[model samples]
Target: MTEPTRLGGFLRKSGAFLVVGGAAFVVDAVAFNLLAFGIDGHGPLYDMPLVAKVIAIVVATVVTYVGNRYWTFGTRALQRKFSRYVIFVALNIAAIGIQLGCLAFSRYVLGFEGILADNIAGTFIGQALATAFRFVTYDRWVFPDDHESSARTAIESA
Candidate 1:
């Protein structure tokens, strides 16, 4: 029956974020693999891994948006639906860039063209970086706390 400390709240929120992100990651990975490297090592978009990644990210973005909106940051003040979705998509585009950069570096720069390498570079490393970016940006901008929400409201009304 005690108030949760700030750190405790953050930890709980982070846990929920991780769960949502994990589900999104699974969707992204499965889609990317299926499109880029099928069961027989030749997927539909096998020749174009970047395109495959973009498509996968798009699908996973939908999952993340829904999960984060209703589960991860459910208690946060709601913003205008259109505006929130636009901002969410913009931030996701940036995160996709992070993922793409890692994948591109592994595929083009490092001359890595294997499933394992792609997963390590794009799925693991890139996701880690992008997840950190998303957590901060989502908390601060996409789903602001009460104070920030009020300030945003003032700015919108001005």
Candidate 2:
């Protein structure tokens, strides 16, 4: 068996990340639209778009964490579960800020508060920026590669 080249490994990791992110994005989009726009343009949090975004982000964060942990970066290492979760949440909060900023810009700065505008600004543009940020930060900090240590730790535990 041969190890993959650097670019190959990166492509593989990024492909998995994209798959996980796409699923999480769906979750976020559905939750946000439901809360902010509702069935017929009047959701429970229609007046509170930011709050709606926060709620949606929370839900989507959970999904992304699980997917990334168990699938995207699963084989790296499984150390410091609680601390990793904390870091993950913190990074996600920063991502949420990115999303909220986009939404706010559309609603306040640009004065385009329609559903289409909100989706384009927050769900699409904001998500793209945040996703890129997450991929970099998560790879560098949250899920550092420690394959040898992880295997040794597993053997020791067993």
Q: Which of the numbered candidates is closest to the native, going by highest lDDT?
A: 2
Instruction: In model 2, state the lDDT of residue 124.
Output: 95
Ten contiguous residues minimizing lDDT sum, candidate 1: 1-10
lDDT for model 1 comes to 0.88
Q: After superposition, how far is residue 142 of candidate 2 from its true place, in Å?
A: 0.8
lDDT of 1 at 70: 84
**Candidate 2 wrong stretches, greater than 4 Å:** 1-4, 148-158
Compute each candidate's TM-score over C-alphas: 0.88, 0.88
* Each prediction's whole-model lDDT (CA): 0.88, 0.90
Q: Could you tell me which residue pairs clash in candidate 1?
A: none
Runs in model 1 lying further than 4 Å from the true structure: 1-4, 151-158
lDDT of 2 at 135: 99
User: Please, what are the lDDT tens digits per residue for candidate 1 over residues 1-158?
Assistant: 14568778888889999999999899999999999899998899988998999999889888878888888888876756677778888999999999999999999999999789988988889888999999999987788766556888999999
